[model samples]
Every structure is written in structure tokens, then in C-alpha cells.
Target: MAHEDASFTDISIQAASSHQVWDPFVRLFHWAIAGLFVANAFFTSPKHDLHHWIGYTIAALVGARILWGLIGTRHARFSDFLPSVSGALNQLRDMATGRRHAHIGHSPLGALMIYNLLVTLLVIAGSGWLMTTDAYWGVKWPKDLHEIAVNWAELSVAAHIVAVIVESLRLRVNLARAMITGKKDIRRDSR
Candidate 1:
């Protein structure tokens, strides 16, 4: 009974130390984009007005997010997570050596993935818009470009999920929960 109580107390202390990393706008943007993407990708008909509206919403959200990235909270800024060759190489070396560094924001490689997705989505939006324009109507290349971009974005999303799970296990961090609750349970020792 005493051991159980001690363990419970320890957990409480640990939880208390967890830091709020994701702000509300960032969290909302993450889940909203995910839901919108899934709806357009799986559930919605391409010819439906609803589908086009959803795509428009996604484009707007991404645009707003880009603006936020410039002037948002610490973890939400482009400056915080911009990818760098040297930084990515160092992160890769850490992975190879089994060294876990708990990042409060996106890591170097993760930053690259984020940028990739953002640009991909923007391309998807642009190509989609072009399809609606009279000049580009029935054009093969824009449609082809849009489809290719969608496929790439889907692949990137899958890879992102896998990487998140792998990193969470490796770092012993609840990253998904952080995105949900806007907090991360990073231990002092881990940092």
C-alpha cells in the first residue's frame, strides 16, 4: 500500500513538470488540417461543392498557419523549426548512436517534413484552383500535377505518423498527447 501511494505521488510530480509546448492555435490548426485532409481524401466526392469548399478551407487554414508561423508562440514559429543540413546530420548521428534528445518543438528532420507538407499542400491548392479557372479547364498537366501532389502529401503524412510514433517511443515522450493537450512530459534528465 505504501509503495503504491509513493508511485502515485511520483507520477503526480512528473505530470506537474510537464511543459505546455503547443499553443491553442497550433493545436487547432494541426487537427483541423488533418480532419479536412482526411475528409477530402477519403469521404468526399471530388465533384461535390462540399469537397471544393473543404479544400478552400484547408487552403485558408494553411495560409493562416503560415502567417502564424511568422508571429506565433515559441514552438509554432518557422524560425524555431526551420530545417538545416548540419542540424539534420547531427540529429541523424544522434539516432545512429541511440542518443535521445527531447525537442520541445519539431526536430530538424521533422521541420523538413513540415515544410514539405506545407509546400505540397500549397501546390495542391494552386493546382486545384487552376482546374476551376476557364483557361485551365480540362487541362491535363495541372490535373496531373494536383494528383501527384496529393499522392506525395499522403505519403508524407504516413511517414510523419510513423516517425512520430518511433520518436515518441525512443524519447519516451507523449507527442500525440502534447498536440492534444498542448503540453509535453519531458523529463529533466532527458533534456
Candidate 2:
């Protein structure tokens, strides 16, 4: 028991000595977006302040995330995970053929979804922002656009959840849990 404890301590020290992977800002932004999204879905609606507050929170979180992607830690940078169309298609092909491999960064399909999420949030935030400006107040166009953006966001989030389920089952690991903990444990050479 004593020997096992000592080995655990050594591993903890080694992990701590390793370079910090997820910056605190990135982690905070991630959880903030996730929480706000959930709150918007369940605790807010168009008829209440809760809805507006949640939306603003989500927008702020997305804005911060965009800024962070431009200049955050290595793993959190957009360059680390943005997927090309061909890459995404190839990942789909690999999935169809059971040839997908584990990766350190987002898989191609997942990366595409990440891009979609960011873009959708931007549109949503823009529309919501317009609603507050005098020039766009009560504008039907902005309302319609915001609703469309929300729909897209909802669909993308649903797809993301489904993909997470599929990946968790396929990889024998919880991807969502990794998002929360910022540590994914997979064979180093799996990909």
C-alpha cells in the first residue's frame, strides 16, 4: 500500500511539472458558454429577463472564446482544431469504414462542428445586440434572424451531444468529461 501511494505521488508531481495545457481563461470561457447555453434553454424565454440575460451571457462567453482562440494557449487556439472541408469529409468516410483514430485535438468532424458553433454564436450575438440598439428596436428582421440563429445553435448543440455519445462509446471514454476536466486519457499513439 505504501509503495502504491508513493508511485501515485510521483505521478502527481510529474503531471504538475508538465507545461500547463489549458489556460485558465479558456477553461473559464468553456464552462461559461456551456452553463449559459444550458441556462438559456431551460431557465429563459423570449418573454423574460432571464432569457435576455442568459443570451447576453452566452454572447459574452462566445466573444471571449473567439478572442481566446485567436491568442490563447496552444491547444485552445483555432489553428489547433479548425477542420478543412476535405478533412471533415475524410473523417466521415473513416467513420463509415470504422477506420477513425484517436487524436490529441478535435477530430475533423468535431472541429467542423466547433466552427459552426462559433459562427452561429456570433450571428446570434449580433442579432441580439441589434435588438438593443435604437435603430433596430423591435425590428422584425432582427427578431427573425435571431430566431434562425437560435435554431441553428440548437441543432448544432444537439448534434454535438449525439456525437459526444457516439465518441464516448466508440473510444471507451467520456468526451464531455474531458471537456470538464481538460484532461483526456487515451493511448499516446492511438491516433
Number of the top TM-score candidate: 1
lDDT of model number 2: 0.69
Give per-residue lDDT, candidate 2, residue 102: 50
What digit string (tens of lDDT, one per residue) describes model 2 on residues 64-105?
788888887777888877656766665566568765355445
lDDT of each: 0.81, 0.69
Please identify model 2 stretches exceeding 4 Å from their true place: 1-23, 188-191
Q: Show the lowest summed lDDT stretch of 10 residues, model 1.
A: 1-10
**How good is model 1 by TM-score?**
0.88
| lDDT of predicted model 1 | 0.81
Give Cα distance to truth, residue 186, candidate 1, Å.
Answer: 1.0
Query: lDDT per residue, candidate 1, 1-191, as tens digits?
Result: 11121111112112225777889999999999999999999998877888889889999999999999999988788877766776677667767877766566777778889899999999998898899889999999999999999999999999999989997887778789999999888754443
Superposed Cα deviation of residue 176, candidate 2 (Å)? 1.5
